[model samples]
Target: MRVVHRLFEMLIPRRPVSHQAKDRDNLQDWKNYVYGRARSAWARGLPLYGSSFRFTIVYLCGDSPADIDNIIKPIQDALVGVVFSDDSLVSDVDSHRRFISDGIDLTNLPALLIEGALSGEECVYVAVDSAGPLGSYL
Candidate 1:
C-alpha cells in the first residue's frame, strides 16, 4: 500500500518559522501556506504512505535567526498527508535553514525555484525520495 520508488519535491515561496515568540502566532499561517502551496503544486493524484523515505530540505530564513531544528518540525508536519501519509515515515533526512546569502548554489537541485533565487525571496525547498540518497541531497 506504499510507493516503492518515488520522489516528491516542492518549493514553498515563504519564510521558515520556529517556536520562538515572534513565530508562534504565525505558525498556523506557516503550516497553512506550506500545505496549500504543496497541494496545489502536486501533480500526483494522491500522496502515498511510503515504507520509508529520505527527506531533504533547505529553507531560506530571510533575516531572522531561527533555529534549524525548530524550523524543521513545522515543515515536516505541514507535509503530512500532502507529501506522505505521516512524518514518522521519514526515516532518512537532511534539513537546514539559512539566510539567502548563505552562498549555496542550489541550481543543480531538482526543486530549485528560479524566481525565488533571483528575487532573493524566502522559501522552503523540500525533496522527499523513497530511493534513499540522503547524502546526495545534502
Candidate 2:
C-alpha cells in the first residue's frame, strides 16, 4: 500500500506595529537596498575585465591623500595581500598602517634586491635603444 502526504499551513499572525511587523519591514528594505547595491557594484566592476592591463610602479611619488586612499581602497576590497618594503614601514609613513598591516604576511614579501637589479638593467637597455644619437652611423 502507498501513502500520500497532504501539505498543511499554519496561520501566523500578521500584526502591524509589533516586533514581527517591524522586522518584516526592515527585512524588505534591507533586501531592496542590498539588491540595488549589488547591481551597481557589478556594473562598475564589469568593465575592469575588458580593460587593458597597465603595470604601475608604486614607488615614492608623494601622492596626495585622496590618491593614496583611492589606490588602497581597491587593494583592500580585493584582498590582494600586499607585502610592504622597509621604506613603507618607517614611522609616520602611513596613518592607517595598523589596519593595512594586519592582513599582510611578511614571509611572502617579494625579493626587492633581485627585482630592482633586473628593472634597472632593463631600463638602461631601453634608454640606450631610444637615445639613438649615432643612428645613421650604425
Candidate 3:
C-alpha cells in the first residue's frame, strides 16, 4: 500500500486533522468514499501507473466535486495520452464507483479504520482477513 499512501501524501499536503475534530466527520466521509473506489479498482487488473488509470483526487476542507475537478486538471494535462476523470467528491458513493470502474489499480490502497480516537491509538493498526498479496509486490 506504499504506492497508495505515497500518492495520498503527495496529493494532500497538509497534515490531516485528528479523527476527534468536528471536521473529521467530513473527512471521514471523503475517506470512506475514496476507500470504496480503491476497493473497486483493486478488483480489476489494471496498472496504477500511466494515463489510462483514473485517480481519485480529494479536496479536504472545502472540497466539492467542481473543486476536485479543477485541482486535478493539471495532473491530467501533464500526462497526455491517458484518460483521466474526477467524477467523485466527498460523500458521493455513486460517483466513486464510476471512477473506480474507469480503470485504476488500487491493490495497494490502505483500509480505513472507522472506530475513533481510541482506535487510532492502537499499536496494531490493521489486520487483513485473508492471505493476500503483501510482500510479493514489493
* Highest-TM-score candidate: 1
Tens digits of per-residue lDDT for model 3, 1-138? 223322221222222233344564755554554344444434324323322232343333222122333334333332222122222211111112112223334344344312211222211111112122435324
Model 2 scores a TM of 0.18
Cα error, residue 128 of model 1, in Å, equals 0.8
Once model 2 is optimally superposed onto the true structure by TM-score, how far is the C-alpha of residue 23 displaced, in angstroms? Answer: 1.2
In candidate 1, list every pair of residues with a backbone clash.
none
User: 4-109 in candidate 1: lDDT tens per residue?
Assistant: 3437777877767785536566888888888888798677767767588887777776676567777778878888888788989988877866677876576554
CA lDDT scores, all candidates in order: 0.73, 0.23, 0.29
Q: Between candidates 2 and 3, which one is better according to TM-score?
A: 3
TM-score of each: 0.78, 0.18, 0.23
Question: Candidate 1, after superposition: displacement of residue 133 in Å?
Answer: 7.1
Off by over 4 Å in 2: 1-22, 44-138
lDDT of 3: 0.29
> In candidate 3, residue 5 scores what lDDT?
28
Model 1: residues >4 Å from true position, as ranges?
A: 1-6, 20-25, 111-114, 131-138
Question: Which candidate leads the pack in lDDT?
Answer: 1
Q: What is the lDDT ranking, best to worst? A: 1, 3, 2
